[model samples]
Target: MYKLQVVKELHSSEGKMILDVDISVQQGSFTSIVGKSGAGKTTILRMLAGLVKPDKGSIHSGEDIWFDSNTRKNKVPQERSIGFVFQDFALFPNMSVLENLKCVQSEKDEEQIKELLSLTGLTALSGFRPDALSGGQKQRLALARALVRKPKLLILDEPFSAIDQETRIRLQQEILKIHKAYNLTTILVSHDLTEVLRLSDYVIEIGNGKIVRQGNTDLFFSNEGKTDQFRMTGQVVDLICENEKCFAYVVVGTMLIKARVEDSMNTALGIGDLVVLSLNDFNPIIKKIKP
Candidate 1:
C-alpha cells in the first residue's frame, strides 16, 4: 500500500495557507483527488513527484520512503520511478514520437520504447511528429513516454481536460487498460466527479486545502457529500425519459441542466414551466458540458 502524510504551507499575498493532508492507497488501486480550483490538488501531486518541497511531512510507498521532511531526506525526481502525464500533453516539438520515448531512456533500454509504442497503439505513428498527430494520438504519445520506463507510480493531472468528447472517452478506456495491465498504483487529479466515479477505487475530496471526504466511490453515490450543490433554482423546459425515468431540463439564466426528476417532485412540470428541476445527487461527467 502507498501512504501519504503531509502538512505544507503556501505563502501568498492573500495570506498564509496550510494544506494538511493524510491519505492511503492500496497497491494496484486507482485513487483520485477531486476538488475545486486552487484547492491544493496539483500541489499534492507535485509534492509526490518531488517537484515541490513541502514545508513538513513524509511520503511512503509500501515499505519504501520517498520523502521525510523531518529527516531532510528527499529523493530526486528521476530516481523516484514515477510516471507523470500533465494536462498540456507536453510532447517534444523537436522529436519524433518514437524519439521522444527514447530520450527518457538509456541506449541499453531502447527496446522498451517499442513495447510502449505497441501498448499505446502508436507503433504505426512512430515516425510522426507531435504536431502531425491528432489530439488523442498526441495524448497517447505523452502517456507512452511516461510508461517507457515502467514507473511504479503513475500520476495524471486533469488528463481529460484538453481533449474533445470522443477522444476523451477513447483515452479513458485506454488509460484503464494500461493501469490494469501494469497494476500501477495510479493517482488521478481531476475536478470532474464523473471521471472520479468511473475511474477511481477511492476518492479524496479536498475543500479549502483540507480533505473533507474520503471513501469508496459507491458510498459517495449512495450519500452525496454536498446535497446543496445539486439543487439549482430554474425553470423546467423539457422532460426527457429513458428507461421509464424522467430527466427534466432546467434553464437558469443562460445555463441549462438535464436534471433527473424524482417521483416526489411536487411541481407538475411541462414545456416552459417556470419551476425548479433539482439536479440529482450525481450527474454524469462528460469531457465537455453537453446540452
Candidate 2:
C-alpha cells in the first residue's frame, strides 16, 4: 500500500492555494484523482513522483519511504521508483522510439524494451522519431518509454486528454492492459468522468484544499457516498422502453448519460424529471433527485 500526507502552499494567478492531502492506495490498484482545475490533484501526483517537495509531511509506498519532511529525508525525482506520463506526450523530438525507451533505462535489457514496444503496439514504429509519429502513436511511445524501467508506481497526468475520443478510448484500454500485465499500482489525474469511471478502482476527488469526496468505485454507487463529488445531478431529457427494458437519457451538466432504468423506476418517470447518479460499483445508479 501507498500513503501520501502532505501540505503545501501554491501560488496561482488568483492567490495562494493551500493543498492538504491525505490519501492511501492499495497495491496494484488503479486509482484516479479527480477535481476541477487547481484542486491539488496533479500536485499530489507530482509530490509522489518526487518532482515537487511538500512543506510538511511524508510519503510511503510499501516499505520504502519516499519523503519525510521531519527527517529531511527526500528522494530526488530520479531516485524514486516512479513512471510518470505527462499531459503532453513529452517524448524527445530528437530521439527515435527505440532511443526514447533506452534513455530512461537504468540498465540495458533488450527483451524488456522489445516487450514494451510490442505491448504498446509500437514495434512497427520503433525506429520512428516522435515528430514522425501521429498523435496516438506518440502517446503510445510515451507510455512505452515510461514503462522502460518497470517502475512499481505508474503516474499518469491526463495522458489521454489530448487525443480524439476514439483514440482516447483505445489508449485507455491499453493502459488497463499494461496495468494488469505488470501488476502495477497506477494513478491517474483526469477530469473526464467516463474515463475515471471506466478506469479507476478507487476514486479521490479533491477540492477546497481537501478531499471533497473519495471511495472505492463501489462506494460511489451505494447510498453511503451519495454526498460525494462523484455524484451526478441531471434531468431526464429522453426515455425509451423496449423489449421490457427501459432506458433514460439524462443530461448531467454538459454531458449526456444513458442509464438502464431499473424496473423500480416508475413508468411515470418521464422527460425533464430531475435525477441523481452515483458512481459506485463502477455503475451509475439512476435515482430520482430528492427534494
Candidate 3:
C-alpha cells in the first residue's frame, strides 16, 4: 500500500498557493490525477518521485518510508524505486535507443536491454537515435529506459500529450500492458479526461492545489453536476439506420453504449470508426469523428 500526505508551496501563473494533499493507493493499482493547468497535479507526482521536496507530512510505501518531514528523512530521486516518464521523451539525442537504456545501469546487461526493447516493440529500431524515431516510438523508448531499473512505482506526467490521437491510444494500451505485466503501482498526470477514464482504475481530481475528490473510475465519471457534459471515446462496433435516425453501437472499454446520430450527422459515421461519445441529460451524442 501507498500512503501520502504532503504539503508544498507553489508559484505559478495563478500566483502562490499551498498544495496540501492526502491520499492512499493500493499496490498495483492504476490511478490518474486530473486537474487544470497549474493546479499542482505535476507537483504531486514530482513529490512522489522524490524529484521535489514537500514542506510537511510523509510518504510511505509498504514498510519503506520515502519521505517524512518530522525526522527530516527524505530519499533522493535515485534512492527511490520509481520510473518516471516526462511530458517530453527526454531521451539522449547522442545515444542510440539501446545505448539510452544501457546508460541507466552502472553495468549494462545486454539481455535485460534486449528484453525491454522487445517488450516495447523497439527491437528493430534499437540502433536508431531519438531524433530518427516517430513521436510514438520516442515515447516508447522513454518508457523502456524508465523500466530499466525495474521500479516498483511508475509515474507518468502527460506522456501522450504530444502524440497524435491514434498514437496516443496505442501508447495508452501499451502502458496498461506494461503495468499489468510488471504488477507495478502506476500514477498518471493527464489533462485528457477520456484517456484517464479509459485506463485508470482510480481517479484523483485536484483543484486549487488541493485534492477535491478521489475515488474509483466509475464514481469519478458517473458523478453528476461536476460538469454540463461528459465525453468518452470508443470504437464503433455497429451502426443501424432507420428512416432519418441512426444508432451507433460503441465499445467504450468494457461497456457498450449506443449513441443516437441525427440525420445530418449520419453522413459522417460508419462502423469501426473511432469517435467521441458525449453524454448530457443521460443522452448520448457523437462528436469529433476521428479518421
Candidate 4:
C-alpha cells in the first residue's frame, strides 16, 4: 500500500501556494489526479517522487519512508523506485530509442527493455532516434523506458496530451494492459475526464491546492439521474448553424462559450442573453470556451 500525508509549498513569479494533501492507495490500484492547470497536480507528483520538499506532514509508501517533516528524513529521486512518463517524453537526443531504454540499468536490463519495447509497439523502431519518430512514437518510447527499471509505482503526467485522438485511445488501452500485467501502483494526472473515468479505480479532484472530492470512478461519473445544481456564469451571443443541429454562442463578458443545441431552447435565446451555464453538478468540458 502507499500512503501520503504532506503539506507542500511552491514559489513562482505568479505567486506562492501551499498544497495540503492526504491520501492512500492499496497495491495494484490506479489512482488519478484531476484539476485545472496550476492546481498543484504536478507539485503533488514531484513531492511523491522526492523531487520537492513538503513544508509539513509525511509520506509513507508501503515499507519505505519517503518523507517526514518532523524527522527531516527525505529521500532523493534516484533512491526511490518510481517509473515516470513525462508529457514531453523526455528521450535522449544523443541516443537511439533502444539505447535510451537501457540507460537506467546494467547488464540485467536487456530482457526488461526488450519486453517493454514489444509491449509498447516500439520493437520495430528500436534503431530509430528520438527525432526520427513521430510524436506518438516518442510517447511510446518514453513509456517503455520508464517501465524498464521495474519501478513499484508508475507516474504519468498528462501522458496523452500530444497524441492524436486515435493514438490516444490505443495508448490508453495499452497502459491498462501493462498495469494489469505488472500489478503496478499507478498515479496519473490528466485533464481528460473520459480517460480518467475509464482507467482509474479511484479519483481525486483537486482545486486550490486541496482535495475537494475523492471517490470511486463509477460513483463519480454516474448518470442514472440528473440534477441542475451546476451553474457556470455566461451569456448567449451567437447561433452557429449546422447541418442537423446548431451550437449556441454564449458570451460571458469578454469570453465566448459554445454549447450544443438540443431544441428551440437556443432559438429562444437571442444574441447578448445573460445566462449562467451550470456544470457544478458534473465535471464536463467547456467545448468552445476561451480561457
The lDDT of model 4 is 0.78
Alpha-carbon RMSD, each predicted model: 7.2, 7.3, 5.3, 8.7
lDDT of 2 at 63: 86
Number of clashes recorded per candidate = 0, 3, 0, 6
- Best lDDT among the predictions, by candidate number: 3
| lDDT, each prediction | 0.77, 0.84, 0.86, 0.78
Per-residue CA lDDT of candidate 4, range 1-291, in tens? 888898877665569877888888778899999888888998888888988888889888888999888999999987788999989888898899988988866357567887888898889999989999998899888888888878889999999998987688778889989999998999999987667755798988888789978888666545223434455565454567788767765534223345666565645655444455656346322332332
Worst lDDT 10-window in candidate 1: 282-291
Candidate 1 lDDT tens digits, 221-287: 4455342454445555456789978776554432445566666652455544455434344672111
- Per-candidate TM-scores read 0.77, 0.80, 0.83, 0.76
Model 3 C-alpha lDDT per residue in residues 123-203, reported as the tens digit of each score: 999899999999999999999989999899999999999998878878888999999999999999998766786679998
- Stretches of candidate 1 above 4 Å error? 11-14, 225-291
lDDT by residue for model 2 over 1-291, one digit each (tens)? 999999999887678999998999999999998888987888899999998999999999878899999999999988887899998888899989999999989999999998998989999988888989888998998888888888899999999888987688789889999999999999999987667766788888888679987887545423232334568887775678889889986656435566789898857576556898887766677888754
Position 277, candidate 4: lDDT: 64
lDDT of 2 at 191: 83
> Best TM-score goes to which candidate?
3
